[model samples]
Target: MNDVQIRTFQVPGARLHYEVRGTGPLLLMIPGAPADAGALAGLAACLSDRYTVVTYDQRGLSRSVLTEPPADQDVAVFSDDAHRLLAALGDEPAYVLGNSGGALTALDLAARHPERVRALVVHEPPLPELLPDRERWRAVFQDVYDTYRDQGAGMAMGRFIATVEGDGAAPPAMPDPSQMPPEALEMMGRIQGNLDHFLAHVLLPVLRFEPDIAALRSGPVPVTVGVGAASGDGVPALSARVLAERLGVEPLVFPGDHQGLATDAATGAEIIHKTLA
Candidate 1:
């Protein structure tokens, strides 16, 4: 395993906590809301031998502390935060991969600062606006946000999870907690603690973001949309397929479900390696 170097960068409204490992070209892995750098540590380790992998806690998530009170998050702000982090890291463009809500951030980053990104892989970006069933999803997400405000995070998260899990005909294939390593357990605990903040401030804004399709299409940066083979025809997979169509590219299939990179890092890493190769 490569020695992980933890660092911090001062952004406009918050201090960002980041981790760096491996040695080669830069590969920045962006995690979705409520998840910190540890969420992507397994994926990073798999890619470390070939590339310098960077993962960070977005503002108000985990060690990335806010200078002011938490409020509704913005995709542009998130992208700008990523922009500054890349600018500070080096002049060369970095390979960027953003998963779930983080994919929204990556889209905005590539649109706004294409010069900073060598290439981008958007893994199941939940852009309802891009989907054929936009209105339905919009109502669903609004209800989730409303539930957070009125009923609290527990109820809101239940609705959110149910929507993401699709049909719900079968129990979700989840890893047994008792067998997970200490670091994995700690990461799970941190994510649970972040739920309130995520549901209240992060979730809705991300789902509501309108990607700059025109800009992304004409930009210099190459973009690849990815979906998990096991994600089925859920909103995430469908949304990714729509985005790929708009971009004139086919959706890349990887291992596992929505959380593929974390659960099947080796296979996911190989797919990413070949895609960027």
Candidate 2:
């Protein structure tokens, strides 16, 4: 990614760290959960040969620093940041790929500004509000925050991961939180810092948000909602299917689980390229 350039975008009280690469049409990739722009580096490099892949740290996370006390975590603000980035990068009607929470942001962006989006590819967005059993998932999500408040970050995160992943799977591959391995301990510290923001500012609001189906239905931008092949029973995969159905289309199956964009970049990028093509 020698051609990749990193820059900052200034919003009201925050500064965003974003990277741009490749030479073709702009193709923005939005990350989800606690992931920063770095999470998308492998995938960005994978797609840079075909499109100018853009990724960034969302505000109040990683390098996107906020200048004031934490405030809005509404999807609209995230969508606005994306809108500004596209205009600043000299691309209008750009192609977009959003994974997880980022996918939700892309949906908001496309819905509010159709003229700025060429086509949208959303993979495994965790939109509980769209699901038939939304209340169940909502309770589970809140339980994560309660875990943090009572038990601690590690337990909170482990539960959160398993809750979304479903099937009683997640978190064992990394060094056990109780073991305190250097990398694992360090990662846990970061998670502790981000967990509060994610729970109070980001995840809660996003969980409660209701997408405007009427707006999305009448919108002109083409959208391809996809679910991870491995996340069949997970909340995010089910949410993707529900969202696709709401939009009068089927959710395409992609390579891995909810975090596939970061973990399976190569295969995920290829699948995205085909969908966008």
Top candidate by lDDT: 1
lDDT of 2 by residue, 24-124 (tens): 88898898858777667778999999898899888888778898899858898898988988888884689998888888899999999888899999988
Q: Would you list the C-alpha lDDT of every candidate in the order shown?
A: 0.89, 0.82
The C-alpha TM-scores of every prediction are: 0.96, 0.90
Each candidate's number of clashing pairs is 0, 0
lDDT per residue as tens, model 1, 32-114: 88788887898899999999999999999988999988888989989999999999999999999999888999999999999
lDDT of 2 at 213: 76
How well does candidate 2 score on lDDT at residue 56?
89
TM-score of 2: 0.90
lDDT of candidate 1 vs native?
A: 0.89
